[model samples]
Target: MDTIIKFRFLGDGDCPDWLLAEINTLSRMTSIKIKILGQTVVKYLTEGDLDEEKVRKITQDAKVELNDAKAMVAALELIFTSSARYAVSAADLSSELQQLGLPREHSAAIARLHTDHCPQITATLSSQSLRVSRLSSIEVLSCDNSSPFSTVSLKLKRLDGNVENSVINISKKDVHVLLTELRRAKSLMETL
Candidate 1:
């Protein structure tokens, strides 16, 4: 038992219902016991007797996990809605969060994470076996316009959180094929 760190969340708007449920479950676990501080406050202690350095390290680790969870939830909410097929920009998502009544600091943190880390995430998700029903959206990544044969890479995140980074080996014939597919898609939609 180390006195590393104790974390408590007042079950208010600061803590979401889902997180409260997670906290409740954590309260029941054997090794790490969560203490109910009051009617609306739930607290968990890491260990009973950790030194100061260990306490700092453990607290930092916990903060990292919390930040990751927050980023994922915020990203999913913005990028994976029922009626849309594309992931919006972080700035756009931040504005949305503000509209939803989240504090600016909270929304800005998520926005910064989305802009900074989401490109890698999008690339990873696009490479997976994601089954999206609607037309795909591309996160503009990079283009090699300087080369004799230019190539472009796009990152995509599917509705189900799968990521992919696809590169197009573009040439004249490839351009024609792409145009043909676009025309076919337009025709099919017109028929419907």
Candidate 2:
């Protein structure tokens, strides 16, 4: 017999009793209101803040507590961000939310929004990632008989919009290994 594991859209501690109760009110809200909430969640993902007016409108329409509305907003952010990070499909996200006690209609609406804005969400997150400069160019200098190493020059573009040059010397065997790894990386990238 095979056991199936379901994907969780939110963390274990993410969904509280209050949030679960809040989600039950989703059925009372109009589809347009639900869509607005979903869009607000996506906007927050990209901009890092929720529209207070929209939140107030949603809270008024849903007849739920203001804190509950805020919690719902926070939950939506967590769900979509986790989904985007894990590359979860929209259908799967809906199913996961449903399993978490979200109303089917609201879950579907949120999932559709996830599908529509996933690319932008992913791009925004990747742009915010911490990393070193990106390699812009590479140059190999001629090896002379006086040395048993090759000199390589690399040009990197920093995140701060500055270009930095780097030079390194490598042994012949290391150069061969580096070339092999670089070729392998190119091959893998082409497959993608």
Candidate 3:
């Protein structure tokens, strides 16, 4: 069954037409319904001299409907002008991932990581720190069973091992140098 999700956008003042268009485009792509609230709806209802209390009451009542519809809330900050932020309740994304048949623990771990660290293109675990290679690749490596300092070395060895590359023991201080050498090697190989 397709899950129907709703989203409410609260704007500081009269909402821009472009913003509404963008939301509509997203809704069309995702098959979700988006509702506008706060000053945007207020302006639509009363062109001038709107009563704040009345708007608040209407907003509260509409919010009840939104809650019943499993809608998430969001706000657009005028200060940012072009940026939009979603107000996602904690674990909401994890729950969605779980529903998609992902292991609960793994989903929770990924969600927590996303909350703590912004999206990475290409990321792999090396030692205790993460090695992010691209913003779009967000891959993770775990050292759950390896020795403390060998984790990153193990990763690098695995990556290059298929071509008969020799393994190297890595210290924490050697990570940068190792990455630089790896990059140079890759560049040289590309030219061959």
Candidate 4:
């Protein structure tokens, strides 16, 4: 049996309790296996070989811009590790992928995650706030487009599961500082 990696899935609303229970039951029966990968994440691997040829065809048809399969895997690894909530928002994921400077079409392939793809990936993005200690949502309120330097007003919902959000109206300079501090804080947290 081939091994499949269960990156990390925190206890989340992505899957309903009943469904999760059923998966657990099946796992216990040895029909499948659930491997806990970390304190807050679990990897679900199944015994089998994936249809790489099919994946290739899909990748080609989708015109994915990743330089190679490893690049795609690396991107996914960063994205999966970037947060503790066991999920990454499409918008946030886009920032990481867009750094590659792929064309819109190719980028779209990477950013194709929508509410339709999986409920876990999107959460209750329409109304839920996640209540988890990570980025739950982001809403762009306004962007001033005057010159090379532009200001943006953003409403970032860091809370999870339908709670009131934190709104910030900030300039580009402030965004840089905030991002720096955020990265530093993230680094500190990872050390723990």
Candidate 5:
């Protein structure tokens, strides 16, 4: 009803066969169990990685195959993370999951977890993501030798609030190659 929410993780809203089968297992779970699993998913989302020990415990408790449990967790992680990225409302997420064949109870549980932890989830996702270090500055010093060389000093600003500095002695040909590459990268960035 609300703009037909599309989850790219679900591949055009058609749930994968593997996930559809896993949903059956999830649907059969008790509400408490589903809530616990949803909490684990939220933890995984906030932490930006899965806890293997937690997954093992979940498999043992759910009495499902290890791979199946993993599949379910992975699917739920992608769904909720994608939903968060899209800024989908909790009710919309629930409806989307139901449309994807998840039971109402399970969808509602997952949506509730998302509603409770959306800010944390989004924050962690933004902070923990891998991004290219930014080049703060570059300085080139030329040697007055028969065979000329350049001392290149680079300052890089990393995502974690660290500044890294490096110095390289480069031949003239290498400097030309580096400039060409930098020009190419600049062109590509501008095109975007």
Candidate 6:
């Protein structure tokens, strides 16, 4: 349950090639967006500096839509993390899990839970010592010392039934929360 904040710069595909390649590359990745005066914004990519005043002024001067710019930054951040194994899209996650020889049933369960029941997914993964969850609207996969480190959480939606899912290490606190939530959900389901 340790809160970790990570950021990444956007890439080149989403923005115009010219104008400013730095900005373009920096705007294409998935990142966390913070709102200022009802406008979503992000820290500067160059140095991880959070200067709202400067960012606002620059956006106003450049005529860039603040929300759009922030979206790009968020996307870039996601991509960067995905590339680094800290996070991944559903497809990438499945591939990684397959490589690790996880079972198809588990992968399917994970994908369904991740896409349709995120809280449950987080809880279930945490129960299995997998530190994978949705944070700030993006999926994050991580590991730490308290659990066995050779695990990965696969996206269930992408499984072909021929591959196995991966395992990951998660914290006890996270597992506890997940278990509690799962029990609550199960109780609710039983009532229904």
Top lDDT hit: 2
TM-score versus the correct structure, for each prediction: 0.29, 0.61, 0.20, 0.26, 0.63, 0.22
Give the lowest summed-lDDT range of ten residues in model 3: 75-84
On residues 85-158, what C-alpha lDDT tens digit does candidate 4 reach at each position?
A: 34656554444334333334333333343212434423323224433355455555666756555566666554
Cα deviation in Å at residue 110, candidate 4? Answer: 2.5
lDDT of every model, 2 decimals: 0.41, 0.72, 0.35, 0.38, 0.71, 0.37
Give per-residue CA lDDT, model 1, range 1-192, as digits (tens).
Answer: 844321121211233445434333322322111111110110011121223343334334444344433333333333322102245666665565554444465546545645555544445445443533333444647767675565767675554567788888786446556657756764554443
Error of 2 at 131 (Å): 4.3
- True-vs-predicted CA distance for residue 28, candidate 5, Å: 2.0
lDDT of 5 by residue, 1-192 (tens): 555545544444645577667777777666667778778888877875667787778668868788877877877787777777778888887887787777788888888888899999878777666445544333343433346787666554544567767676778668778767766765554443
Instruction: Show model 5 residue runs off by greater than 4 Å.
Output: 1-13, 128-130, 140-192
The candidates, ranked best first by TM-score, are 5, 2, 1, 4, 6, 3
Q: How far is candidate 5 from the true structure (C-alpha RMSD, Å)?
A: 7.3
Cα lDDT of model 2 overall?
A: 0.72
| Backbone atom clashes (below 3 Å) for every candidate | 17, 0, 7, 9, 0, 25
lDDT of 3 at 81: 16
Could you tell me the lDDT of residue 166 within candidate 3? 35
Give RMSD to native, each candidate: 18.2, 5.4, 19.3, 20.7, 7.3, 22.4
Candidate 6 clash figure, as a count: 25
In order of lDDT, best first, we have: 2, 5, 1, 4, 6, 3
List model 6 lDDT by residue over 75-177, tens digit each: 3334333333333344544343333333444334333322443333334334555433322111224334445432335332221234334454556556546
The global Cα lDDT (0 to 1) of model 4 is 0.38
Report clash pairs, candidate 5.
Answer: none
Candidate 6 ranges beyond 4 A from true positions = 1-51, 86-192
lDDT of 1 at 119: 49
Alpha-carbon shift of residue 77 in model 4 (angstroms): 6.0
Single out the weakest 10-residue window by summed lDDT for candidate 1. Answer: 35-44
CA shift at 191, candidate 4, in angstroms?
A: 30
